[model samples]
Target: MNGEDELEELDEESLHDSEALPAERPNPLIIAASVTARGGVLWLPVAGLLALSGKKKAAGRALTAAAVAMPIGHLVSLVVHRPRPQAANIPARQALPEHPDSSSFPSKHAVTAAAFGTATALEDRKAAILVTPLVLLVAYSRLRTRVHWPTDVLGGLVIGALVALAQAGIGRSARARATACRLFAMVRPVLSDHSCPSSVSE
Candidate 1:
């Protein structure tokens, strides 16, 4: 948490990005880390909160936002289907597979992480800090997996950002609606039979 630590972290990240990996080791580790980080975000504590909480409305907002964003992301992935780094003329140190699948556009890992990350962050601020690193790992995994170019990771990042933004918007709108309902609740007795307007849609 010191300036030196921050500088060291920054330098490490730069090395990760800029260094030409030996074409075998980095990708696998990146891919594995991506899975572990993302799994941690989606499976346990956050999922448990969604399952156990009585705050159905808030949890529902988060889950619904995730449900909406994920497919749209993959759909966008298909639309922008760019070739893998190995497929383009860029020479990798690793040999290309004989049957290379052509879809290397938006990374599914990134999109998945984004969708879940946005949901968790919107649901609870503390969760976002934990989720943030997964986003980076998933983005990096595309390269480490040898399934995508760095630019593909970049594109996936944009897609993830947009997805997160959209979900966050939904969360915002839900909050606004809840606020309106509370406001209405205050005024309901004055004219509307003391009825608290429901915020069920959010």
Candidate 2:
């Protein structure tokens, strides 16, 4: 064959070889982020750590946030029927094998991440700073994996933040009530003693 024909043949073979090659795998970091974002993976460990460190209130808040966020997310998902990227015929790189058979309106992972992260931050800023990246990664991973739309993730964040704020407010109110009760108890005995002597003298 002439040089031109030989070059053309080599080019065709190279093209075919490239096409036969397997699709590139997703980044390891992205995979790790996706896995860590699982409902019980990241937040559960965090809560456990907080409890072990004697930060019981912070731990309780974290657990409460997750518990509340997950159910709310599911309830919203049930109300809004949105398809995942792949199901909607949009191009997506699914990193995880398990495709959840549920509406993808709001990512539960994002909700849990935001709720847990926000609650923890409210209780401990330093700890929040440490976990902030993981929380962001979890949110990003949902998009990167194409399991959730951007709006879904955004909605999840907003809902999670609201839940955290509500929980924080409740905690503060409970503490305030407990303090008031303690103060009233402390003064009640003094008032009773004075009134009892006055009545006896009368």
Best by lDDT: 2
Query: For residues 68-182, could you state the per-residue lDDT of candidate 1 as single tens digits?
Result: 5556666876787666544233233233333346576666556666666666676667656765676666666555546555555666566656676776786579888888878
Residue pairs that clash (backbone atoms under 3 angstroms), model 2? none
Clashing pairs in 1: 27-144
Off by over 4 Å in 1: 1-20, 27-29, 34-66, 87-102, 192-202
- Estimate the TM-score of every prediction: 0.61, 0.76
Question: Stretches of candidate 2 above 4 Å error?
Answer: 1-25, 51-56, 87-92, 190-202
How does model 2 score by TM-score?
Answer: 0.76
lDDT of 2 by residue, 1-202 (tens): 9976874464334212133321234467876887776764777777788788778777788779878988899999999998765532322344576668699778888888889889988998877877678788888777665666667787888888889999999878777766666666667676754332332222
Relative to the true structure, how large is the alpha-carbon lDDT of every model? Answer: 0.56, 0.73
